[model samples]
Target chain A: MNMMTGVSPWERLIRPDRVHGSLYTDPDIFEAELKNIWYRTWVYVGHESEVPNANDYVVKSIGPQSVIMTRDEQGKVNLLLNRCSHRGNQVCSFERGSARSFTCPFHSWTFANDGRLVGYAFPDGYEGQDKAQLALGRVTRVESYRGFVFGSFAADGPTLREHLGGAAETIDRLVRTSPEGEVEITAGFLKHRVKANWKFILENECDGYHPAFVHTSIFGVADSMIGKLYGGASTALTRDYGNGHTEIDLRPEFRKRDAPMSWFGTSEERLPDYTARMKAAYGDTAAREIMIDGTPHVMIFPNLFIAEIQMFVIQPLGVDDSVQHVTALQFKGAPDLNRRLRQQTMGSVGPAGFLLADDSEMYERCHRGVLARNPEWIFLGRGEKRQRQDELGFTVGHVTDEVPSRGIWTHYRNLMEPI
Target chain B: MLSRESSATLMSAITAFLYREARLQDEHQYEAWEKLWTDDGVYWVPANGADIDPERQMSIIYDNRSRIALRVRQLMTGKHFTQTPQSNLRRLISNIELMDEQPDDGDIAVASNSLIFESSLRDDTLWAARNEYRLRYVDGELRMASKKVILVNNDKAIYTLSFLV
Candidate 1:
């Protein structure tokens, strides 16, 4: 219990039906979240395809702290702190580049791409100093699952597999879309800046309820068949796969159509070459199911979001600001499909997207609305009574339910509350 | 090189066309702006930088003629929230230069700089960019064949840019 407020953290901030508004605006709570959540968990760093070649490095952030994900000489991906150990200067300043070694500008301290101290300008000055100790600080644990890299600051906690839990199947489904069983993130990212708390994005990404109201303009409910995928009458299900991961499973609805590639708004005739390749790779039945199922609309807790043809990684800048970096997923042997994916990504995502622009506006409006102080709690009680476990043991509800947000908050409360 | 008089006339015509296009955009004259583009128009606003390939790398806005019409239709819907209460916008076009005097497939290239001032429901934002245009004459009327906007800070995080750049 807090000595000043005389209230336990979970009771004061999070509850089953609602969460306190202070969780979105308070600086102290944001700091605590940085410690308890972002720093402790296995936060996604970068994709292995991003650094496909040796010496390639991309600078990314765990929370607010900058770190570099580099491909060493042996092609092993390494996550090292961007800071220089000598005088706390940033070693690499470029967003991404292929460099032989990172040479710090301040003291001319040079380190190899894999965080090995190669040499320094004034070596005699540190005659007795242990150069091994001064190498770049590395994250305690680094793991990769099918080219998706994640890093953890804490030495021990949940492994990436344990953290992903049942959500790993969603990732497997995405990779299987490629005929070669590989997905490449070669296309650059589109960073959409949102003026709201980072958690809003986590909850909103899997949210099927608001798409009907929020994106009515894009979907054009009167004539759009896609409009029926969400709202009260839709048969789609929202699943809370344990450990804070969740999915808006549209398979039931897609299966109702009984058409292959209907999820992508395409069909067998249009992509015959792709269909043939998929058949050759995974055989006819599995490829047919893969095309029908499409990609998963899911969030891997804390950061990663797999949105069908695109992937989004949310970066928290502060209590009331965040940036969502998104990229169009490229299939390994599907050139025809990759072209369509790029065009669709442009139409549906980024700052000028038809769908995302309205969502961005709502996120900002929600942040501004929370400043009103009267409603101390944000309602998340929708579908709580009807939610039940599916055959996969995941908590399931209607597509328009708050089961995902409730699951996220439940996991968050467990992390924040004293054990 | 062309004679000085011909150069002056070309400059004047291009400048007039740019100012008129800017007015159409600032006034939200959707139909008039739509008419200004050729049937095969391509509107591109590259993300990261202007050098990346649009086909391989992601861009902020990359639209062919059909997509351009769709964008206009979405804006005209009166429901796209980013522009429900349309952003009050005015932009300054300057440093107009004729990059190519020779017509390549009936199109001449021109370049200019833009400083757009936008006031929306949230806050005011100033956007700076270099705009490159491919202009062509269709039945004695100047039409835009292509337009590419390279934002000054395209490499960094950018806010909602729903309005035409």
Candidate 2:
């Protein structure tokens, strides 16, 4: 392997068809990721529904940076760094809440929900210190599309829309499945930790080849029920939607099979009621199409992933540990539909879910496997030398192909390389 | 309130029921464990806090009798990958007492604190929880109408909780 003379260690780690094992195990490489990918890219924060009211706020993260996503007095969403200007203690410690102002427990320096310095306890202690200048520090930039908010540490780069690129349709299609065209986060979230690199989860999210083998116990028991509806594992449409995003859609045959893919229940029990509800909201044709649409597992690059009715954020805690916070998105007007979605969400990905538990073990096993000294390179050449561009300009491939993994590594290498 | 002798007898009966339940799971007697539940039984492990409605909020594990049958079936099939190296577990149950009763049903609500030791592969995880059992003493049989586990570490991220807790 010839190393490019001027390339740094991180840049040299990535290859076209395979990546070095150190990329997943080295703590030094984790630091490089923070600088190259986390700080440089636009990271998703929270959804608009989370902060619908004027004072509502939720603490989020952009890489290692803690940020507060709040709706201000004038009804505009603000992404403010959680650090207190005076001595830097986190002002908002709770996960999510609604309040007019944030007060630092360390010194009681207060800032409004919009990140403006409201007041301070010892005002006279600083005679010439400008209160306005002492306001809460915010991330470099914050932007949103359709209700999903995002932030970046850099002052300038590609806008969120441009960064989303071909993946915007994925997000749009997700929220559009709602009858009211809006989705709300369920009452709470389910969080679980996996001892592995975060990218492993990202890769597993789009890979269609692993599940039937990994979750064979769960799926095997329900083979008759699942096999009838899903048709077969090979029929899914797996493709890369550019900018490192990917989707593996397996429900395209729902209508053709007369099955409602959205429901985990059998088609006979769900279609009559579920289809009728859709028809009432969107009329017969659109309703039928929407019900039949395969609920794809869409991975928006670095972290955000949505599958079925659940949305989750993967927070990287350390080199070997990452936390996944999952929220079941509920329909605005459909109570029964929301309940079913909740059931499916718990059944699939929640902490004690039938599926996520399997994936977590696999990820830990992958991390542990790479601990071996030999086998320096992890082969990723499942389906190579074949790719296509969809109308939306996303790179497309076979459902079982490793094209998504290749796309991720390619974008990852480009992002990590120093300019 | 029952007499002191009556209360002690009731406590012993419930304690034996709880211990037998744990042993059934430890020995992989899932079918035997399944038979301990009532037809309308609910098995819930609430997240964030206790008494949370599974239909209204997210849960770590929430299943009615039928769903519980499905989960148990999967575990028994030797296919759940997380359980590939099946967990070795023992529950230390303590602080058994009767909880506040529901007015309508002839069910006794039993509460206890437990420290469950689960080890698989090279990892040993200590799982702590407040176990609340809604048992109906039907025809001299103790049936699990509901079991709610409020894990002390429920708010934190957990890995491979494949075995029943």
Candidate 3:
């Protein structure tokens, strides 16, 4: 009776210590995740800035389902299935626009911005049927916090506030830096396709161990900048912000370290005065928060990541491929010249940017290696023994440690396995 | 003392200079291309066809001479990973037309149709766009005051664009 006794793959995942490589590459597991995690969880869509006016809408994806996020005449935001009730055709084909109603291309079925059934091609087709119930299907819940929007698929789960937990403070800080207490997405976005597992981006961004090696060339250029400015000492500081978040703080010391003295002759003198002008405009506290020493890169677990001057949304296209959308953000009342400067700096990190291009190449190479035969697990044991607990109950490590990456993978495993 | 024939000849010279600039970019002769700009020249790739200002709408690429030089420096460095397996690109420019000529301000407005072909190890990409250039003559040489590119598929989902278009 017990002849077939053995550990199942599912059972193996339930174990705490390790995960098999199949979790990264298996088609079955990918399908399961699409159904259970992505479809069932509260996923981020677009920010409120995207649709600031009534009738404005943006197309987004939740799991495999394409949805439309729009504001109605009453100013309530609706997340409804993009498909038409008649023939499953996409209702809103454009990336974004302001429209009072969407008409299915295949059939002339129209739905209001509120997702209500407005009109049909033929009035005689459904003489006495329940036409009112044939409206576009809506998401289980659509909630927003600090202008960021999120939607859940399940009928029952924690609220958006509960889901964000301690991470809400980070978003608050981001908005508080803006003088108007709000920020809007700048026009145009940078889109790039990476040939790596979607989880890899989440892991790499927080993993401080790889940068000094993976980005040696970038550091080399930056080193020259530091040497010329600060007499050969680098000024970058990397810290682990517990619960899988890591922040890279670049300060004035970082700029001086290894920088060329000649590099600052023109721009440096102008920057401080400009910042001083901003300080006068927004007050000292706001200016200090906006400046933030150097640039601060923060990663919100699973998919959302924010750089000081930009916001990125990483969407999983498949287990082996992901699409990244990068958008520059602007404070409501900043000067034109300063906005241009921010855009220029943000450009250095786009698909065409020096740093991002190199990073994507490395990701592709890693994907290729993992796909090869006899691939071993990539270890994250660096600084594991030296981990020190912080006051917030998070373990901290040296700047060049794998603690952050391990933190992300640990959460990944926790989510993949049932409690 | 200039006649109509001389005016036509000058127009031809301006058109040739513009064509030469495109050739330099296609050949990756960035140093020579950089010389084709005025001191305050601007390169703009708007995200939308109707965009009038880079200050408001998002642009795919916007660079002044200094930022453009920085981009070149970054590309030439050893750390530019995205280009490890460097991409090779070839662009075709055609349908050149003179939209306006303002000799007083040393400026001319021109329009052209272009097609960009780029190849990498992963895939080959084709970008077709309409272009407009506002050139200002500096010391008797045509230099760009502004250059704008409007792509056909700017709003669709796209693969990595690791090179200039």
When 2 and 3 are scored with TM-score, the better candidate is 2
Off by over 4 Å in 3: A1-26, A213-296, A333-342, B1-19, B50-52, B100-104, B136-142
TM-score of each: 0.97, 0.94, 0.84
Per-residue accuracy of model 2 over A215-302 as CA lDDT, tens digit each: 7788887653443333344455678776788787656545456555433454524545545566778887776566667354788878
Better of 1 and 3 by TM-score: 1
**Over the stretch B1-165, how does candidate 2's per-residue lDDT look in tens digits?**
889999899888999999999888777788999999999999999887786777888998889888899889888888787888788888888898887675366788889998889887638888899998899977789999999999997876776577887
Q: What is the C-alpha RMSD of each candidate to the true structure, in Å?
A: 1.5, 2.4, 4.8
By DockQ, the candidates rank as: 2, 1, 3
Expressed as tens digits, the lDDT of each residue in B96-164 for candidate 1 is: 999856565758899999999999877899999999999998999899999999999999888899988
Query: What docking class should model 2 receive?
Result: medium
**lDDT per residue as tens, model 3, B1-165:** 347798687678767986788777666676787788888878776654546476755566677777676666665674566655567878888888777454556478777888988787656879888888887768887887778877776665555665656
TM-score of chain A of 3: 0.84
RMSD of 2: 2.4
The candidate scoring highest on TM-score is 1
Worst 10 residues of 1 chain B by lDDT: B99-108
